[model samples]
Target: MVAVIAGPDEMVGRSLPFSELSDCPYVVLLGEPGSGKSTVFETAAKAASRSVTIARALRVSGGQHVESPLFVDALDEDRSEGSKKDKIFQLRDKMLSSSLECWRISCRVEDWRGAADLSALQAATTGAPIVVTQLQNLSVREQAKILTSRGALDPEGFIGQARRHGAASFLECPSSDKMGVLT
Candidate 1:
């Protein structure tokens, strides 16, 4: 997956492989609804030698016993009626009280409240810089690769048809629903 550090100039920033972000102590991954944020979060959790859910991590007391990052996905999936700011502040308090050293949180770009949310989370950290990154749409080559891997009988033909139908953008971010239509 490709990503870039999110900021005012992010559109022109250089992109990097998502794997390179593991070294960051705090990361807030923002992506469109079907941009694979949850997939990436799950992949990281599986790849990490040691990892825990943020909820479980928060339950651990006595400070930083867990030596790995805590992974939190679907930050925007909360069904609570509370305001976003309230949720962020509650998460901040939990992180501070638990004294967790590392975290990776994923949320839909539309749901993210920008710097305010980042600032709240940053306050819980031990001065480690918080790096916010946004997931990028899949390049055409990447989309083709996925199609090939999935045993598409005619990946190029499908791509052409999608383009003709003005649905090519869906190819860049294939969610389950979108994939159903494409495949």
Candidate 2:
């Protein structure tokens, strides 16, 4: 998958492969619901050559010095009985106390209020740049590629039918269908 990354110094959106973000010390991945945020995080974690720490945001705690890559998934999936903002603050505090050199966090676009929520993580970085990346919708070509790889006999025909029926938007997001068929 690809994402549009905006760095601290540069607000201009630049699309890059998710794997290219390895150098970033801190990253916040924003995407719509069911936009494959967890899928992307899991893929990256699996592809990591070295040891990578993975955790859910709600279970994250401090005192562990993780110098390797860290992947925290599903910030919006917290089921704790408190405001999300409070959870964010608590998460920030935990991050602040931890010795994390590189970390990537994923949250739904709607729940990520703005830069204010990331103040604590930014502070924790201690001069390392914090990058925010938003996952983009899959292009028609990419969708077609996925369909073809999934054994679709006529990928273009399926896309054409979807477009004609005004259901093309669904093709932009990944689904959990085992057959990989659009239907």
Candidate 3:
């Protein structure tokens, strides 16, 4: 369905179908910058009526607030070349151990050189399921390349690992479904 952007001078835009959402519990939203990536996430959260904490993708340094069902907005600024994959791995470790139910992680495709490190990380960490959209710039092939170069042993093993981790990637009741009904 066509979705309207809520900003002051924003225009209407097309949207993905809810049914297209991943069947798995966790979701990672992958997309290029300015591809309405964040909007997609906000829309999903609004539709599900779930509360989401948006954060920049980075190591939990001093003041970064980590929340469940988190939307990692943008990581384009992260130029940690060799450490990039490692950082993602560490982040996944922390997330897996958290008590959050569902998480939607959005990262710019160009940031990781078109990699799905976020997805791999989520799979490793929480075993909670995740959904991802493509960043506008990179192609799926490029994303696959990045995932491979990073030494992700089981690229598509997120779902199984999530099951083993026992972390419910997504909240049973999406926030969209929780909106108060009108009388």
Model 1 spans with C-alpha error above 4 angstroms: 7-12, 49-67, 79-85, 174-183
Mind giving the per-residue lDDT tens digits that candidate 1 earns over 1-183?
Answer: 555565335333657756777777888888988777777777777788654354323433435444447777667765234443356666667677767788888787888888788788878888977777888877777777778777888888888889999988888773532446445
lDDT of 3 by residue, 56-78 (tens): 33346444445554555544444
Q: If ranked by TM-score, best first, what sequence of candidates would result?
A: 2, 1, 3
* lDDT (Cα, tens digit) per residue for candidate 2, span 1-183: 555556765544777768888777788888988877887787777887543333343346445555446777777766234554457666666666666677788888887767676675676676877788898877788788888887888989989998899988788775432224454
TM-score of each: 0.76, 0.80, 0.46
List lDDT for all candidates, in order: 0.69, 0.70, 0.45
Q: For candidate 1, what's the RMSD?
A: 4.1
Off by over 4 Å in 2: 1-5, 8-11, 49-67, 79-85, 175-183
**Candidate 3 off by > 4 Å:** 1-23, 57-67, 78-86, 113-131, 135-183
- Screening candidate 1 with a backbone cut-off below 3 angstroms (N, C-alpha, C), the clashing residue pairs are none
Write the candidate numbers in order of decreasing lDDT.
2, 1, 3
**Who wins the TM-score comparison?**
2
RMSD of every prediction: 4.1, 3.2, 19.7
- Candidate that scores best on lDDT: 2
